[model samples]
Target: MSDDLLKRTRAVLPSWLAIYYDEPIEIERGEGRHVWTADGTRYLDFFGGILTTMTAHALPEVTKAVAEQAGKIIHSSTLYLNRPMVELAELIAGVSEIPDPKVFLTTSGTEANDAALLLASSLRRSNQVLALRNSYHGRSFSTIAITGNRSWSPTSLSPFQTYYVHGGQRYRSPFAGLSDGEFIAACVADLREVLDQSGGDVAAFIAEPIQGVGGFTHGPDGLLGAFAEVLRERGILMIADEVQTGWGRTGEHFWGWQHHGFVPDIVTFAKGVGNGLSMGGVIARAEIMDSLGANSISTFGGSPLTAAGALANLRYLLEHDLQANAARQGPVLFEGLRKVGSPIVGDVRGKGLMIGVELVRPGSTDARSADAARGGGPGEPAPEIAAAVLEATKRRGLLVGKGGLHGNVLRIAPPLTLTADEAAEGLAALVAALEECTP
Candidate 1:
């Protein structure tokens, strides 16, 4: 049945839209941390639909809210006063941490980021922008311009003149051998150089607290804070692209930027806010949010249905303190991956449920091995080994995701409600899979 569907999908869908596995499984349903294929084969879900199913599969609170809201009304354009939208915005503003915050809803992270770009460029009166190397913002025309990862950026034409800077990822970095303080200083120097060459009046500096598609990699803590101080001095706004790192997924903080020791001028979010619903938003100071002279409205941005579902999802996440759950479970999962003892596993890093296991060739003098030998360097990225491990894990009834500049990093992000037993089970399966694929 899946084969037929796969054939139809391939015939119609764009080839650029990648799917996982040799034979992609059609997920028919899900509950909690597991999903079932069309053939009723159950697999432990580790990716959580690319970290979208944030709370749990089929969460009752979100489900009920969507159903109830749909019964009354699904959408009424932003022209009317939307109660659900207002409620959700109020909640988001309360927790946004930005001073004098204002909220604008959108359908996806791409749109949210597009809105942010609009605000920054208009306010600064310049199309020049700064973005982190090895970072991804979105797929839209405006966002692809700022994306540093070439694989994701389909074109060079862009409305904004974007300058890529260093220091998003520590491993595989030119400054990888430096101490945290030294690394931050080098990155700051690099930023200043870019600013000097950028012809000045750079609009904003955008970054992910943790690079998601760059394989969940990040620099030393307070690195962005250091960058922020420099950008602020030059009147450059800081925009935190928290699409993957927001809402306590990082565990230590409700927002990933909080880890950087400063608040951003603008914060954009999506992917887990509505528990798999199509929702995204941006929060900013009223001055920036209202900078535009003309009128604008998102026809379907804060529709009744999505806003209600997102509101319920947020309430549940906070009430249950899923952020704390991530904090508790993240260490258990992180340590388990470290203890897997796979020769191919080179490095494990990230906070909370958002963890990455980078792969390398066995017996190679990679950074992990070099560090052990007091050498300290990066490994040759082993994308082939990563591919093999993906198939092996699937055969073992586990589902994980992969990404990296070299495509050699395994991304393990389960739902925040992950149980202790589930973690152990997933770890055992991962260990066995690695052993099966090991040379």
Candidate 2:
């Protein structure tokens, strides 16, 4: 039956699109952090659907809310008020520090970001948006224009020439080993150059609180705050693209940028905003959002089902105190990985549950010989090591994801529901995978 299903899917789907893995598994069901294949194989999901399943899959409360909402109504155009939408907005505002926040719902992070970008650019009457080189905003035209990753922004050149600024990421910092102040100064200098070079055309300086796809990496301490200060000075609105890092994933606060002591003019969240349901939004300072009142809106945005799921997911995360749990378990997992002490483990960096393990050519091994044997040409970024590690982990019934421009970093972002014992199990599997993949 499973083979027949796979054959049917293969026959129906287009072959030109890239598959995520060399071999893809036919996942049948999920609960908590585990997923079962159609053939009865269970795999522990460390990536959590790319960190979208914050509350984990098949959460009873969220499922019940979604079902109940389905019975009532699915969607009402933004032109009319919906009960669940209002309640969801209130719930989000209650958790945020922003007073009198206004919410604009969308179906995905990309649309949310696109809406934010349009608002920011329109309000400031500026065409340039400054973003970090390693950061990801989303894939739509306006959002992708601001996204810094080349993989997503793949044309030889952007038609609109979307401007960007640099941020302080210490792992591969432009100015490594600098003090926090020095690093921030460098980042600010880059922003200044971009702004000046663009003849002050910059409207907003946008960034992720901590870069999620860029190896689950943390930015320099106080770097975001410093950038905010610079933006304030230059009249550039600060936007936090917290789509991946928000909602207590960082543990210190509900919003990822809160730990930095800075508030964004516009904050967008998706991914786990609805705990795996299709929902996203931009929470803005009331004044900023109001400025764009008539300029933008979504047809199916703020649907009752999405709102219900979001409210339930938010409540569940808050009620269970999962943020604090992420904080506690993050260090435990980090310490265990560090103790394993493989030479291939070049760096481990993150906050809370969002972690990145950077793999490099181990100093103890002959890098050239290893690359030759692994079929990776010289200076090919060593993502082959990451791939081998992932394959080995999967063999042991564990799953994880790779990130970084080079795909050489292992990203560990399990559901917020992760337990200490479960973390230990996942970490053990990772360690074993590393040992197996090391030269």
Candidate 3:
């Protein structure tokens, strides 16, 4: 049945819409942290639908909210007074760290980012923007221009003149050998250089606290905060693209920017607030948000259904303190992966439940061996090894995701409610998979 569906899907879907695995399985349903396929095979979901199913699969609170809202009404465009939308907005604004924050909802992270670009460009009256190297913002025309990753960006034509800077990832960076303080200084210097070449008027400096599609990579802590200080001096707004790192997924902080000890001028979020609902939004200061003289509204942005569901999901996340859960379980999984002692596993990094294991060819001059001293330098990206491990893990009834500029990094982001036992089980499966794929 899945084979037939795959054929049908291939016929209709765009070829660029990448699917996972050589033998793709159609997910039939989900509950808690596990999902079943059309063949009734169950697997523990680690990637959480690319870190979108944040809280859990089929969370009852979100389900009830959606069902109840659907019975009442789904969407009543943005022109109407939507109580649920307003309530959700209020809740988001209260949590957002921006001064006098205002929220504008959208349907996805892509839309949220697009809207943010519009706001920043319009307010600053300049299309000149600064984005970190190896960043993946979105697939839209505006976002593709800012994206520095070659694999994810398909086009060069862009509305903004985006200057790609250093410091998104440390592993493959030119300054990787530097100490943390030295690395921060080098990146800050690079940012200043980029600004010098921008002819003075740059709109914003947009960045992901952790590069999601770029393989869950980030520089030293406080790197972005240091960059923020420079941008602030130049009247450039800092937009924290928290689509993957928001809603307390990072564990230690509610927002990823908090980890850096800075408050951004604008923040864009999606992927966890609604758990699995199609929801996203931008939060900014009132002055910046209201800078647009022209009227705008998202048709299905904050519809009653999505808003209600997202509200329930956010409430549950806070009440249950899943952030604490992520903080607790993240280390268990991280340490377990490190202890696996897989030669191909070059580096493992990230915060909370969002972790990445970079695969590499051991013993190569450009690659770090499993037992190599820490920060020996990033090894040669072994995308083939990553592919093999993906297949092996699938065969072992475990699901994970792969990413990075070269697709050599394994992304391991599970639902925040993941337990220690489940982490152990996943780690065991991963260990077996690595052993099977080891040369």
Point out where model 1 deviates above 4 Å.
Answer: 365-376
- Shift of residue 89 alpha carbon in model 1, Å: 0.6
Q: lDDT per residue, candidate 3, 236-347, as tens digits?
A: 9999999999988888898999988789999999998888889999999999999998977779999999999999999898899999999999998889888978789888
Worst ten in a row by lDDT for model 2: 364-373
Ranking by TM-score: 3, 1, 2
Candidate 1 lDDT by residue in tens digits, 54-134: 998899999999999999999899999999999999999998999999999999999999999999999999999999999
Predict model 2's lDDT versus the native: 0.81
lDDT of 2 by residue, 1-439 (tens): 7567557777999764344455677878899989998879998999988899998889999999999989988878778888888999898877777767988888888888888888898898877778888888776667777777776665544424577666635665545546877877888788777777888767887788888777776667678888888788878888888889988888777788887888788898898978888888888888888886465556888888888998999999989999998888888888988887877787788888888888877753324433445543223356889888888889999989888877888999999999988999999999999999888
- Residue pairs clashing, model 1: none
What is the full ranking by lDDT, best candidate first? 1, 3, 2
After superposition on all C-alphas, the RMSD of every candidate to the true structure, in Å, is 2.1, 4.0, 2.3
Instruction: Please give the clash total of every predicted structure, in order.
Output: 0, 0, 1
Please list the C-alpha lDDT of all candidates, in the order they appear. 0.92, 0.81, 0.91
TM-score, one value per model: 0.97, 0.92, 0.97
